[model samples]
Target chain A: MYVYLYDTFISEAKFQNTIARVETRLTDLGIAGKICRLSVLTSIEELVNDAVKNGAETIVAVGNDETVSKVIPLIADHKVSFGIIPIGKPSRLAQLLGIPEGDKACDVLSARVVTKLDLGKANQHYFLSRLEIPAGEYEIQLNGQYTARSLNPNQTITIYNFDSLAPGVVADRSNPRDGQLELIFSGGESAGLGRFFNKDSATESVFPIKKAQIQGLNQDQSVIADGYTIINTPVNVGVARSRLKMIVGKSRGF
Target chain B: MFTKDEKNSSESETIIGPSVQVEGNFNGEGNIIVEGQVSGSLKTKGDLRIGTNAKIKADIEARNIFNAGEIRGSTVIAKDKIELTKTAKVNSNVKASVISIEAGAIINGKVNMSQEAAEESQPLELQDKKEKNNRK
Candidate 1:
């Protein structure tokens, strides 16, 4: 199948060399010479233009999920299958697809099988992840560092914490019934608890939800989706119903 | 059904740094650690980790989401575990076989722990449902 490669040429000195190497490998694999257009982009607008102009039946996004995120909206309505040769820092979607690291992605692309999947919505915008509100008066230490705490809602006031700042305060408002969006909230106990204790709290309030109407938050709040951040708040996210056609390799048997 | 031993086994843990942000659906089969923010849906057969500063706003379908951070939206599928640490905060509905919440964790949402088939393992049920609907 003819494919278009959307390569995000990160201008970092090291990345320039890395991009060259990837191009060389593509040539060695015989993909560069035939069946693939290594579409390189320096800007989002250029990325869209190049992709539209290439007119390749399949789009093999060759960066991390962030790069793919840029193209998702462009291709959401178009009939195109997406393939990923993930080489970026973290390719969550690629990892999920079991697309191997480095050059091995060639094999994944070669053996990929197209399957239509559901897409999510965030306030009229189509995305893999929806909008989010931070926890109430919460502080967490990850990788031994404290960050993004100021944005968090203060939980000392129980009402503000539970009513306005919690993750799923909008379940009823952002329902996931259409079968695309999967609303999520993150609060529970640590992993070390025994099975019984875990069950109790999980059964209590604050697990996760399908839809909701969150209160007391807006665009100022940050949300993380797919692997991209800086999402506007007061966001309403849901499923887009039938929207994406993904090309999963044979190993997954999708 | 194939035995556990027959399945491909890998043990590399991926870390999504706090600076990174992903905005799309994610489905995978290996262990994932999220320190950054994620929006959209996540589904994996392996373990999932949410870093302290990480924020996610979407549906989650994974074997487990070891929460040390924050999440919002719905948890459509978590077959194994959904652990929330003291610093964890989540406000959303959850559908999981197992879940854990720590003393300081703040959670405000509904959680359903009904015994249900894993999404991938429900092919037979789906086929049957389709057949039944056709008959109807």
Candidate 2:
């Protein structure tokens, strides 16, 4: 069974046409199943659990990256295949998965090219992308063997699972299916004036880690996972190897 | 399965770039490339490469070493070859199966050329004590 999850933001007037087109396409392909529109009062855990209990073999996120983030960990935990239909802005996950926008995504999902991806677990939350932390007086312990800390505090410590920051600086260096994460210490510097600046990073180091403990030395710090979700410092990170069976396009960027 | 996009990247699993400084015991099984600064002890089962800009103060061990950096350490042991480039400067007792030193490379302390000599050589502290006795 296929259950399509729609985010609350998808109800805006801008996405009405897009939602209709996707539904029509899914029906046309005879692959349409239950549709669950997530609202403010909806319990995401209950909704996903109910879908799984009702025999949803595949859970597809019908909105943007936020929608995928909320649902992917659930379906992955339930051992169900996942898909994405990126509708609007802020859909970098779909882009990395090579799923096109709107109704075009339905065709790729119908092709059913499923691939396994590793999920990064930071404490309780599951993250598909990397985890970012400001490198400021922090101690990074990798595999509990050695500890690494930066002499310069004005940098970022990014632990990548599904390497989406494909800039040429640290390009094509991280692989999610390798059962290891790339812990990168880098500083992002912006060049240019005003809002037209571009962020360039010179990667300081790369460490392949199976387990990591990031602790702050000066004060408590913030750790951002997949961009928006923030976890406090002293975070324990481990790789959940091949945790997600995701439908991806042939042209997907890793 | 999706076709993978192949791009050239560093073959070394561990890379210490030019902008960071690492301390304490750092060891790994894979190849290591150091371009920055390191202190304490560094060891790897695979090959090690040090760039010209690197400054290292540690006990180092690897299968092979290609160094062009500046090292102030107690000992450096390589199971295979050790190549010190023209820009390299070492202040450590070094042992390897094969050793090559280019012009302008400065090497301090004793150098053991063969892997068999590693088993025959005395411990670092014992050698130091022997040298002191000879001076006396």
Candidate 3:
């Protein structure tokens, strides 16, 4: 059975209309499910826990990127599958999953094409997109053996769990399920002869790493996970061993 | 910093700014343009352009490398060619099939131009071990 967790922040009219459309489609498709609305008083974790306790076969999120990110870790390790019925603004996660916006997303969910995708962990929190730390000097230890120091003190470091979310930022390689994270370092301002001679002076360094430890923070830096600021500097980021079973569109890019 | 258009370039070209300094392992498939300071190892499938004011101390591998900056430490191996501009100040060994040095470029190390240079430019033991572990 599927349990739909709808975000309460959406407009009442649109929310009700979406629920009705989703129910109609599920009924027409002969899929079993129940709809639950998320409120300020109730936490997403609690709602997900309740769904699991009730033996929900699939937990569907009906909101935007933040909502999906919040629900991911709660159900990732479970045997149950996760689905998304995107509402409101377009999301990077939805785009990567190939889930269409509006009522059409319901159709994709109904298709029930499930794929196992890797999850990234920043300390205790899990993120599906990417994590960004402000530009700074850092000592990075990759996959236990390789250790490197940031030569540029103002370079921004980003760890990507999904390559599509990075858009034009290209790396040497990107395989989300390969149990590795894509680390990108970008920053600095070009000056001197480079500005006068080389029009393309901006540079970026990319690495495909499994585990990384960033040290030498000044305590003012913030770590942003999936577009949300979560923790301070000096954090541990890596790909989690557990995978998330997601219902994606037929032409999805994971 | 990258302009709005360069940041969104579909070619996946990378640009590092002049004021920044980075030390780590960088591997990329597209072109890279550095205008700052970079230490450690850099490997790219496409061209690598080091700006005139840049200072890099690392082993590098790329299809083609255009250096107008200062490079030291390990050898730079280019599969296709290596170009040293007038402002280029290099203090490391270089191995490339083709090498071009403009007037005023300073070199403090050996330059090897031969097919055998490819085999001699293999990554250091640490990088080789890391690659082996990645394959496993």
lDDT by residue for model 2 over B19-66, one digit each (tens)? 677787888899888877899889999999887878999999999999
**Local distance difference test, candidate 2:** 0.82
Arranged by TM-score with the best first, the candidates are 2, 3, 1
What is the TM-score of each candidate's chain B when compared with the real chain B?
0.72, 0.78, 0.75
Model 3 chain A weakest 10-residue run by lDDT = A165-174
Interface RMSD after interface superposition, each candidate? 14.0, 3.2, 5.8
Ranking by lDDT: 2, 3, 1
Query: What are the RMSD figures for all models against the true structure?
Result: 17.0, 7.5, 9.2
> Which candidate's TM-score is highest?
2
Q: What does DockQ come to for candidate 1?
A: 0.03
**B1-136, model 3: which lDDT tens digit per residue?**
2333554333445555564456777776778777777888888999988877888988989999999889986789999999999999989898889899999999888888885665467668856886799999
Q: What tens-digit string does per-residue lDDT give for candidate 2 at A153-181?
A: 56678888875545543456777788988
Encode model 1's per-residue lDDT on A1-254: one tens digit a residue.
Answer: 34544453554565666567666767776666223333442555455455557675677676677777776767777776777777668665565455675677776666656666666655555664344445543222221211122221221111110111123332232222335332332334335754455332221111122233333342344445454645555444445565777776554312
TM-score of 2: 0.86
lDDT of 3 by residue, A94-192 (tens): 888889876788888888898878888887778887887766656667656455445555456788887564544543245567777877766543466
> Which pairs clash in model 2?
none
Top candidate (DockQ): 2
